[model samples]
Target: MLGFFFALPNALPADTRAKMPGMFQRTINLGLDLQGGAHMLLEVDLTSVLEQALENEKETIRQEFREADRLRTETIRVDSENDAVIVRLRDAADSDRAFALLRDLSKPVDPTSISQDKTTRVEKLSEKDFRVTITEANIADIQKRTIAQSMNVLRRRIDPQGTTEMTIAPEGDDRILLQIPGAKNVDDIKSVINKTANLSFNMVRKESNNEAAMELARRPGSLSKVPPGAAFYPEEQGGGLIVERRTKITGECLKTSSEGLHPEGNYPIVNFTFNIRCARLFGDLTQKNIGQRFAVVLDGVIITAPRINGAITGGSGFIEGSFTLESARELSLLLNAGALPAKLVIVEERTVGPGLGQDSINAGKIASMIGLAGVGLFMWLSYGLRFGTIANIALTTNIILIAGALSLMGSTLTLPGIAGIILTIGMAVDANVLIFERIREEAHLGRPPVNAIETGYRRSLAPILDANITTLIAAVTLYFVGSGPVRGFAVTLAIGIVMSVFTAVVVARLITATWLRRKRPKTLPI
Candidate 1:
């Protein structure tokens, strides 16, 4: 009865399922192979993460030097190819002082290993030039930490509500494996993950002349020559714009975001609010730069650059662009989930259609029915009607118990799992066969029916336990060492092994004992 209630949800209609009690509504979940879904392999762009870190380090160096009155440099640049920061001192005499200051600025390798470990080693290229190369150990550590953080963020973004049975796990040092069951739209999930969603506001760099702006735009390689503290980002609406690299506000300050319609244009937009501290800072920024153009940058593209008409002190704002309703909602969802630490590239994508899944499920059902029928016929024919009927009853109970256990545990059922179930049916009957043959031997020895049955079960206990335990151990090992479909097979095999033991030994014994008490026959049915 408990098994029936537990397995009831799978056969009920959607509306009927909702009407059922929660305890009776639990059902076994289907795997990607059974129900169809999306499979995605994403690789994190670790190089981009390193480059961003280098940029931050460069900014820190500039700020530290600016605060120090005596330190002076011609230019501070990050050499990505060489993986080092170059500090060109204006005067050769200042090299020693600059190196000492910069060395202090570099992070300590370890607080305990101050003397032995240093994050950066300063090398004097020439009297006026010094290079600080970051340690390889530090870079590797950053990559490891970034990948872990990226995996966590990806999981949160993909399964925000946590209702879906999805698998999001790290594949390698820089890759993520995603298997989402019942996910119909692969592109939707991909788009959410691919967007870094890093939002920032920066003031547009005012050019001295149109020729300078056009020249910088024409020569993409001349981005390094844009200015001392500015970046070149192409505008979403038009050509390009040179913007201040220093962020006035970032998405970290954002409290919440939602999709909404633009007040004036009625187009889709993302409405956002900031915390008190950021709201005050934003108000001050807009107040000071009323006539200056402020660029809203997402990832690297300039979404919009509009002049600040007046001070925005409401602590809220809206972003308007060429966004449809769905796009606006997606952007809001990404913003609400927080931004990814690094960009994710979809290296592989596979969409399993529901039709294929249905076909596989049908084939599995047909195979399972055939196996069950064949096993049942052999069991009944070999053992006469009385004992054969007892084994059949135990077999039926075993199936129900397997389904009930799976439903209760919320495990997924795959095609391989169905095969495990079929295998379990054969194994269950094998145990009964051993016990029945023992009973027949004891009956031939002139033992009474009840005594023969008792002795047969007692003697068969060791062998039954030995066989099931060995199989269970193998199933457990497979579960721990394998993945995906292999794991599914292991889970079902393990569960079926346990349930088969119960039905074969305890359940069948109970049925035979009840029959013996009712009809005290002089001879055994076998």
Candidate 2:
């Protein structure tokens, strides 16, 4: 009963057991271990991750400590090696107060506990000195968010998705690993991932008001105001961002989108549906300002700024620009992928080719079919048809759960990943065999059928968990260390082990329980 409860959650649900209207379970995906293709390892550049974080935080810090500058000019510099921000005053008059502020920033580390000299503020500061250190927690957060965002963004950048299988996940505290089985045009991925993806909405600076612009510009970080009814267009890779008005609407308003042609001409356009919340905001903005042009900017460039013909209360609109069909599709994908919590830097990249990925898929399929057939035949030969059929039924359920899980995760199955699935299939029955053998032994020892079947499952629980845990450790370690297909193999294998444990222990037990209740057998076949 304990084992059944423990494993039940992992098993396939009643509804999932039903295959698609016509398709069968045997025809599913196979990963790259059995199929061969490109296998490459990628590491996220944490150096860049920390640098971006520092760059973003630099201005905020200056704002916070701006008052302290009254005593002397002070600046905060990030020391990447030590992962600490060093604050220095132009002169010694503010050093004491600087240290006091530093104390306030320090949470767990007490500044007074450290040795200090009367001559100079603590000679050196380590990562422990900072309030928020770029340790695993910080790195983990950046890694996870980056990977998830990158997945959606990259998928968007690629149109008419092909037979490419790739896995992206956190490799370590500050690194991400990407694996592609048939990756060929790796440079395409590089181009996609290397972008900073920094987006902003600011009032465009007008050249006619050079004096005001220069004054605002000279204010160091101040943004310039746009001339009334005028727009600013900066050249390629221009110095900074400028907009006419604060964006009344952003990408968040977009609920659904589709690519289409503009009504007036051949130019590409993106039609979008906005949520009710945004619909109200947009309606008010458009209704209030009928003649204003709203800039549709992406990244930093002004993509389009259509004039408000009238108040749009329908919650649907189109973005018209001098875009081609391809560009329009890509734009729609970016909008659909959603906004990022923080800007992302591409530290790694890879691309899988359809040709290579297809070949790998074929190989993986052959290997999986071979593995399944071998396991099924062996089980039938070793055990009688009755018991063997039941084991195969559980194995089928295990595979379904794995497939459903992969689909749910939106995970791409690679070649080595297919090998993992095959290995899982072979090993999944070990628990079932253990339980069956235990039942047989009990039957031979003259125990009643009901007691023997229940006892078999109850006793096998501990050994099952112990065996799977050891393998899980190896799988997790390989997932961290090895790249590409290796990680794919690890992911599928780990998932399979979990699914197998459930189907073998719980699903098989349920079937046996139902059978025992129905038959009420007096003598059991050993």
Candidate 3:
């Protein structure tokens, strides 16, 4: 009954099969080698993470001095070459106070640990100059955390439903491995994974004009002439818009976002709702800066610059740009997934065509059938009709149980996994061969048929267990140390070993017992 339940999913269509109860719905998933999919190796830009950290530290220092009257500094700048922040104090007398404040802000190693692994080290460069270097420990910790966060964001963006058989895991220190089985659109997946999706709202510079912005945007040489505290960003449609460097709202403030069509123009747009605090803050900003334009920035490019006609208190707004339905939906999906901590570069990409996968599956199926038939024929010929038939029944049962077990566990079957199944056919019959030989010896020794049968099973049990256990250990080790197809092979090999033991010892023994009771043979077939 359990075997029937497990095997049902393979016979029904996916939609109809899913309607069944959970216990009966599980089916063996095919691996990428057997099912077409996209394979990608992404490397996280760790240098960007460190640079962003430095910029954040610089901003924090600026904000700290602005908030604290006692800690005053002339200038705070990030020195990329030195990988540190340089702070110039207005007065040398305030250096000690500034250093103390910065030290207090440094991250502690742990609450319970006595070791002091400060995030920053403040060194006195001169009377008024101080150099703050980020610690190696902090960089390592940030890199680790950022990679983990990026992987999670990538997973959410690539497999929102989580039903697709996808694997996203850390490959190395700064690389991630992604495998999606049966993926049709590889480019779309790549685009979704690569997008940083950093969204922000910055007000337009009051003194900046479209003429100056356009000139700066068109001619790279005119960049130096652009006004201070303002930068030009390419507009979505065309031209450019100059906006302030400081952002008033960021993507983190967004509570929800969805794709929708504009009410007036009927063009696709991404509608967003902000959290209560950001909503109130946005309302006040719009109310105070009426008639002024604010730029909606996505990943540093200005998507739109809409003027505030009146105060907006609803906390809801939509971004307007030249967007198709698909692009708008993708944009909303990214916003919902949240932004990645660092940029991801595609180090490697591979796509397996469905036709090729089908070919491999067919080849594996043919090899498996050939192996099974050869093994079955050998067992039937070596042992005469009744005993050979018994061994064949156990062998057939072994295959069914292996399939049922794989289905029950939801294990992926790769090409190599099919090879494991074929190998199991021989191993299953090998145990029966040992038992049959032992029975023949007992019969030659003048033992009764029933006694010979019982002794044959009892004497062969230890050796069979010893051989399968050793192989099982090897399969487990392979699973732990290997990846991809190697792991798939390990899964099937281990399961086959287990099922073979059951069918050989228990199933075959029961069949022999039933035959003995029904026929009451005077002499053994051997």
Candidate 4:
């Protein structure tokens, strides 16, 4: 009865559902095959994962050699062609020491394994020079982790509540299978998933802000080398700014983010707050760099380069760019969920239409009525009118309970789910059939109607429970092992089985007991 109340909301119109409580607002979500939606095959950039690892290692080498040995930044350069970092020491005598340092920093390719293959392979390029290349095992491990993280991040960004029934799974070595049901706009979703959202604040090179330097940076083929720990990031407005690659605070420090409008301009902006630890860090960073300017970089592009006139002790800030209302909301949504591990390139994109058209759905409804009517008619003919009427009522109640449970659980409904519902209708009466046959046998032995009904129910209980329990186990197994439509079928079928038992044993028995008590029939109807 409680479930029936919950199921009632699904029948209401959208306007009515909105007026009801949140608990009753959920209707069964239709899958991509039933409702038009976006479909995408995203290929994870495994190479970008490797490149990212190399960038981190490059930073480590730059910091160590620059501080410890006073080595010039220009001496250490990334060997992009060879996929390695090349370091040149000022003193030839420090060669052995630097090699030892590199070896010490190198970790096992897989920390869980003792395979002896190290992540970094350091070799002497020349006297006072060494090359550090990432091992194949480490590259593969990084790629695998990227795919896993990408799937999780995508799930959180697209379907945080887990009710959208979006499918995000590994497709191949370096690809993700993505399907968003009822998502009308493909481009919008693509934008949400594609952003790396790696936000950071870095100090700008004071000299780079000058007109001559700014013009030089803007030239198409200037061929200027960026400073060791700094890169030229293009500002949102027009020019470029050379900013430090390292940051004291990163996007990982953010606790929450929301979309808001700029106070003065009323332009859309993303407001962010940091956790306690990062709050103090932000305070100290701004306090220390009060006279200098810092660049807010997102995915390597400088969004804003505002001078720190005063310290921001509050640990909160807003991100502003050329953002529309929709984009700002999307940005905030991504920030709250967290950044993607690597890039996702949409290699395949399309919109899927419903598998069953409106006419086909109408036909299905008609066919369902005919089938149910036939089943009810057979039950009425086989058993007497009173008992068959009770069985049909129980069957009807079982379906309502199934739908109610499904709505409450927020499971997606598909063609396979509808098939499961039809299957439930046929199986709903199996318990009644068993009990009825037993009652007929009891009547043949000259038992009274009351005694026969009691004996039949008591004896049939064990077998009915045994059969339902075993079938329930199989349905659960299917749910666990399957994906997509198979899981949909399993979900509906399992819920139906449980509801069938309730209506059969609990509901049918109650009605029959009351009728038997009031009427006080002497002879068995069968």
lDDT against the true structure, each candidate: 0.85, 0.63, 0.86, 0.83
C-alpha TM-score for every candidate? 0.76, 0.53, 0.80, 0.84
- lDDT (Cα) of model 2: 0.63
Which stretches of model 1 miss by more than 4 angstroms?
A: 37-43, 90-175, 178-194, 203-225, 234-249, 252-255, 261-268, 273-295, 304-317, 320-324, 338-355, 381-384, 408-410, 429-470, 520-526
Candidate 2 vs 4: which has more lDDT: 4
Q: Give the per-residue lDDT digits (tens) of candidate 3, residues 379-483.
A: 778888888888989998888888888899888888888888888887888789989999889989999999999999999999999999999999999998887
Candidate 2, residue 331: the lDDT equals 66
**Which should have the higher TM-score, number 1 or number 2?**
1
Candidate 4 lDDT for residue 333: 82
* Error at 25, model 2, angstroms: 8.7
What's model 4's lDDT at 519? 92
CA displacement after TM-score superposition, residue 425 of candidate 2 (Å): 5.9
Candidate 1 backbone collisions, by pair: none
* Winning candidate number (TM-score): 4
Residue 318 lDDT (model 4): 95
